[model samples]
Target: MKVFTQFTDEEVRKAQVSVLELLLINHPLDCPVCDRGGECPLQDQALAFGPGASRYEEAKRTYRKPLPLSPLVNLDRERCVLCARCTRFCDQISGDRFIELFDRGGAEQVGISAGQDFRSPFSGNTVQICPVGALTATTYRFAARPFDVATGDTICPHCGDNLDVNDAWACDKGRFAFSFVDQPTRLTTPLLRDHGLEPASFDETLAAVATWCRGGRAAVLAGGRLSNEDAYALSKLARTGLRTNDIDARPFPCDPSALPAERAQATGGMAVTYRDVELAKLIVVVGLDAEQEVPILHLRIRKAARQGARIVVIHPRRTRSYDVAEHV
Candidate 1:
């Protein structure tokens, strides 16, 4: 079979219209009620190039809505067009064959195997890649529409041990934690606890905390997830403002004697980047589980492997990257 790789803009539009027509044949037009409504690719494509009218007057197929694929991920089979993108992602990228096309032809749809849950570290990627609202994050389902929320860029704090800020990608925690910003119970202002916790002015809260800190030995232990700016601010506040040397940013306990060595590795003149991984003749991944620890890095290494580059992983347990690596 011959495949056309290139096409004119007009041809592309016509193709898109035909594609959307078939996709929408059994798809429910419940955009207002869908979790991916405002930010959906089909939604955008439909507006840009899809046909204004449907020729099919037949009734749409129906199924049980939103079968639970996992605790975090849900599958709306009706919205699925049997693209197999999610299944392919699981089989190729994530190495988790949890979901697959169960039935054949028009009845074909994405589904989790019997006695299996979509329990992959990179499961959310499937949700993000679903062109339609076939896959959705359970926690974020119906939480808010795309236009109803604001977005801003920030660093991932999940893996704070890595000091190189330029190569960071959003882990599951970093991607989903932003939802808390819209939570009603989230703290919006400083609180003072004298007899009981009470909302107080920033100045008053700072003054009270300063007074208490000065009265006794206090230490500021920051989490790895803090942004560079926030970490720096906290460090300044601890040393200059609080007048204390008892401040540390490492969330997990590490040997004090190894601090300088670790710092050197983090800020060294030489660094291994995504490009380096791609071009390297020999890549050795130690202790690090790229699938869970750094999925983006895993993708880079996988690409390199496909290019005939050799990879070696040294770990007690096998990782998803091991599937592509030359040796484990």
Candidate 2:
């Protein structure tokens, strides 16, 4: 007789549902009040592969709710399932050794070290990687729902890294500094100036723009903030729609022809990437200060330096990066 194990999609889903049902036994159904609502993994899992009705009808376990992990990090002990993802990340990746599982078995809970604060540079990652809404950023807590906000895949204006500024995994600045995007004084509608500026529909605005461009020389001055697709569209519009050959994306170019070599170097694609920085034996820093300019870049440089990469900074004044640099 021969026996082999086989699991089909339905069987796997059933097993998943069983596990999730147990996970959700003590979980609160306060999805509306949760900041991670609409983007929560626990909520998604329950909806996708879970028992339609919870069989465990006992009163759910409760804690004080949102025990202070640190000034930046908050812990909702009741929401936690003792999954050590955050603890492991802190121990292995960030090297902070702050967050850890306290106690054992049924009493196991994740927390910061005794008398130690979760003050690591990468503490935000814990709030991001929490499978449930167990860990949350104090600043972003109850600020907005995931569905209420719009997300754009944009590069970090600080460091040019391809990161979504509004994402859960975004750095503190990228996530919380976007409140300016919704200022009450900020323009929300397209403005057209006939005698004075007045809000106009997009179609009307386009018609007015077309009228202004017709039989006139027009140059598309796109910004670096524009996505590559947007830049391409604007380039095409300059040639096909506007009937002009002048189009520029770089903001500081007084004369595009003056610095052909520099322009090529700037737009010729990345000469050195984060990978190169990580693997290089010697890294020479020019005018760029990684720490202030790009915290993530600084972190990468620090990691590389820790791995025996020699860092040399060439600047008149000492930068924050000089802490990690071999020479300044």
Residue pairs with backbone overlap in model 1: 157-225
Candidate of highest lDDT: 1
Superposed Cα deviation of residue 57, candidate 2 (Å):
4.9
Off by over 4 Å in 2: 1-13, 57-59, 157-170, 178-270, 281-293, 302-328
Which pairs clash (backbone N, Cα, C closer than 3 Å) in model 2? none
Which regions of candidate 1 fall more than 4 Å away from where they truly are? 1-18, 47-52, 160-169, 177-267
lDDT of 2 at 22: 88
Q: Which 10 residues in a row give candidate 2 its minimum summed lDDT?
A: 251-260
**TM-score of each prediction:** 0.68, 0.58
Tell me model 1's lDDT, rounded to 2 decimals.
0.77
* lDDT tens digits by residue: candidate 1, 1-328: 8654325466666776788899888889879999888888888878877789999998899999989988888888888878788898877766678888887888887887788877777787788888888999988899899899997655554554333434443345555655766899989999988799999999998888777899336888998667789999999888887778888777444335435545666554656677888888888776667766666777778778877899987776776778877888
Deviation (Å) of 230 in candidate 2: 21
For candidate 2, the clash count comes to 0
